[model samples]
Target chain A: MKARGGVDWMVVVSRLVFSGVFVWAGWGKLRDPLAFADSVAAFRMLPHPVFVSLVALGVPVLEWMTAVLLWVPRWHRAARWVMTGLFALFAVALSVAQVRGLEIDCGCFGSGEPTKWSVPLAWGRAVGLLGWAIWYGWRVRGRSADQ
Target chain B: MREGLREEGLRMAVMVAGSLVLGAVVNGVRSDSVPWEYEPKAQRMSRELARVGIKEGETREVAAGAIELGEFAGMVREKSVLVIDARAPLFYRMGHVAGAINLPREGFASFLERSGLLGKDKSRAVVVYCQSETCEDSRMVAESLRRVGFTSVRVFREGWRRWLESGEPVEKPS
Candidate 1:
C-alpha cells in the first residue's frame, strides 16, 4: 500500500513538471512564430516554405493544448499520450538534423537568444521527457484500476 | 480496440483544429502581426536559406537578387561594388577576394561600425558571399546590410568556390 502511494505521488509530481515545461515552451514559441519558423527551417524537414510556415503556426498551439489537458483530470491520460508523441517527433527531427551535420539553432525555445542546436543534448532531453510520459501513463492506469 | 482507436483519432483531430482556429484568430485580429506573414517576400527568402544549413557546393536557381559567379566577377572587376566576405576571420585571413573586406557574421556589427560602410551611399551595390553555394552566411550578412538601409544588396551564390574556379585575384590576409 505504501509503495503504491509513493508511485502515485511520483506520477503527480511528474505531471506537474511535464505540464510546466510544455506551457513555458509553447508560450515562447507562440510569441515568436517567425523565430520558431526559422528553427523549423533549420531542421530542414519539409523544406517547403508553405508547409514550414503552417508548422510554425500550428505546433505551439498543440503544445499549449497538451499542457492544458494535462491539468484536467479527465483529459490527463490523453495529454500524456500527446506529449509522448511530441517528444518522439522532436527526437526524430533532432536525430536527422544531427546526422546531416546542419549547424543551426534548435529553435526549441524560440529565437533572439542564441541556442545552437545540439543533437545529443536535444535527443537526451526528448527521450527523458518521453520516459516521463510513459511512466505517467503506467502509474495513472494502475491507479484507476485500483479504484 | 476499434472504439479506442476512433476516440484517439477524434481527439487528435480536435486538437489540431483548435490550434488552427486559434492561430488564424491571432493572425487576423492583430495589426502587429508576426513577421512570418507580414515581412517582405525578399526578407522571407533568408528564412528559407537558413533552414537547409546553406551547404558548401549546391547551387540554387538564381532568385531575383542572386548573382551568379561570372556576374560577380565582372562586378568585382568594375570596381564599382563592395564585396564583403562573410566567412570567419580565420578563413578570410587565409584568402579572400583581392579587394573584398572581411565582415564575418560573428563580428559583423563591430566590423560594420569600424568600416564606415553604414555611412556610405545606401544605393551603392554591395555583394556578399561566403565559402560556397550552401553557405548561408553571405545571405545573412547581406540582409543585415539591407536592414541598415543599403538599397542594393545581392548574394553571390557560388561564393568562394566559383571565385576560385574562375581564378579571380585573391589576397592573403595582411
Candidate 2:
C-alpha cells in the first residue's frame, strides 16, 4: 500500500495477484480440457455441444489472457473489466444451477468430484472473484498507465 | 474519456478474439481435444438402447419419470418404492438414502438376475439416485430398470446430494 515515483506498489502487487490467480485457474483447466468440458456439460446450461466446447476451450484461454493483460498497466482497466464479466458469468451460472437444484462441479479451476457443498462453494468463489475484479478496477482508477 | 473508452474497447475486443483463435487452434491441435459437439449422456444412452432393442441385457434408457424431492421423501418415508443407489460400493456403504439397495453401475451390465432386484414385480415403483448433481450413475441405473421391465421407473434427478443436504433420512451400515 505504498506509493513511490508516481507508482503504487500496492496496486502493482494487486495486479500481480489477479494475474497469478488466473494463471493458476487457467493452468488447471488447460492441463485437462476434456474433463473441464465434462464439468461444463454437467451444468446443463449450454444445451448445445458447440457452445459447451467453445466455453470449455475459450474460458481457460480468456483466463490466461486476462492474467497477462492485467500486467500491462495500460490494459489494466480492460483486463479487470473482462475479468469482472467472466466472474459475473460464473456467478450467474452457479446461481441458476443451484436454484434448479443441480448438484454439480463448478469446474472453476479444473474438474473434481462435486459434493453437497460444492455448489455454494463455487458460487461463492465466483462472487468473490467478481468483487475482487471490481475493487481492482477501482483501485487503479486515475492512475497513469505506466504506474 | 472517449479515447480511453475506444482503447479499452479495442483491447478487450482483441483479447476476446485472441482467446477465440488461440482456443480453436490449441484445441484443434491438441492430442486430447474435446469434441466440438457433445451428446447428452441420457440421449446417448437412449440411442445405444434403441440400437440394441427393448429387451437387451444392457437395458433401455428413457426418461420415464424424474420424481420431485417431496415425492422421493415420501417414498423414503413409506418404504414402498424400491430405492436403488447407483454409485460405487464404497459410496453405497458410506451412507445412502434409507432402505436403498446398492446396485452400482458396473453391476447393471451383469447383475440383472443375481442381484434379486429383478425378482420384484415390474409394476413396483422404482426410485434411483447416485452421488450428486454431476453424477450420472442414477440415470444409467434407471435405464437398466426400464430394460428389465420396471414399469414405474423414477429418477431422483437431484440425487444423493439434495437428499443428504436437506437432512433427509440416511442409512449407514454397521
Candidate 3:
C-alpha cells in the first residue's frame, strides 16, 4: 500500500488483500459444509434445519462471490457493501452467542477449526473485518472505476 | 449521485441472490453434500410419534444432563471422561466411540454385573451415548449411572450420529 502520482496505490493493494481474505474464508467453509452446518447449529439461534442449511451454505457462497466481484471495476463498491453486511451479520451472531454464554466453535473460518478461539476473540475478529470493509467503502465512495 | 447509489444497490442485490441459488447448486453437485436440510433427531422422533398417534410424555420423563458435541469431543479426545455406549452388542461390535464400553440398556443389570463397573470410581466424569437422540436409551442409561453413585454423568444426547457426522474419531473394536 503506497501513494504514487495522485493514485492511492495503498487503496488498490488493500482491496486486493481484502479480497483474498474472503476467498480463503469461503474455501475453508466450502470444504465441508455439513460440518459448517453443525457449527451453525451450535449457535442455537436458528433451531430450524432449513435456517441452519441456508446460513451454512449462504455464508461461504457470498464470501466467494464477494471475492470474485471485488476485482470487477464496476462491482467493487457493491462487493464492499456485501462484505460489510456479512461482517455486520457475523458480529451480531457472535455477540449474541457470547452474551448467551454459549461455548461453541466460532465457525468464522470453518468447522472443526483447531484453534479454539474464545467466542469473544472471534467476535473481535468479525468486528475488525467489519471495520475494514467500512473503511474501504468510505475510501472508494463517489469514485467510479478502479476505486 | 442517486443514480450511482441505485446501481450499487442493484448489483449488491444481484450478488446476494446469485449466492443463494448457487449455494443449492453446489450442494446438489457435491458427493458429500448434506441432505438439503438436516432433520435433527428429536424433531424426527416427534414427527414419527405424531404419525403413530402417540402423544408426548406417554413414558416416564428422563432427565437431560446433556453435553454438546464440542465438549463431548474434547472429553473423548482428552480421554479424561469414561464414555459408555448404551446400544446393544450388535451396534457396539460395528463401531463405537474410541475407548467406550458397551452397557446395553436392555441388559443393563446383567452387563453391569459382568463388566464389574459397579466397583469403579463413582466420582469420575462419565458420558453415556447411544445411536441417536430419537432413542431414550442414553438418557435412561445415564439415569442408571447416576443412581449407581456415578456423580458426574452426562448424556451426549446427539450421540453417535453427531459424533460420526462431526468427523470425530470412531473405533471398531477387534
The parts of candidate 2 lying over 4 Å away from their true place are A144-146, B42-134, B137-174
Clashing pairs in 1: A41-B51, B54-B134, B55-B134
Where does model 3 exceed 4 Å of error? A113-117, A145-147, B41-174
The order of the candidates by lDDT, greatest first, is 2, 3, 1
**What TM-scores do the predictions have?**
0.59, 0.62, 0.60
lDDT tens digits by residue: candidate 1, B1-174: 788667767777777788877876775676534544433233444443343233233222334589887788888888988989988776788999979988866545667777788678999998998887665778777876766678898999788877988899898856
Error of 1 at A76 (Å): 2.0
Write the residue-wise lDDT of candidate 3 on B1-174 in tens digits: 899889989999999888888998999899857566765434433443444344453223266678999999998899999999988687899999999999866546667767777789989999999877655668767766766678998999887888889999999866
Tens-digit per-residue lDDT, B1-174, candidate 2: 899899989989988888978998999998868777865545444444454344334433446588999989998898898998987677788999999888765534444455686567899989998876567668787876777578888888888889988999999988
- Each model's C-alpha lDDT? 0.72, 0.79, 0.78
For every candidate in turn, the CA RMSD to the true structure comes to 10.8, 7.3, 9.9
| Top model number, TM-score | 2
Between candidates 1 and 2, which one is better according to lDDT? 2
lDDT of 3: 0.78
Q: Is the docking of candidate 2 incorrect, acceptable, medium or high quality?
A: medium
DockQ ranking, best first:
2, 3, 1
TM-score of the candidate numbered 1? Answer: 0.59
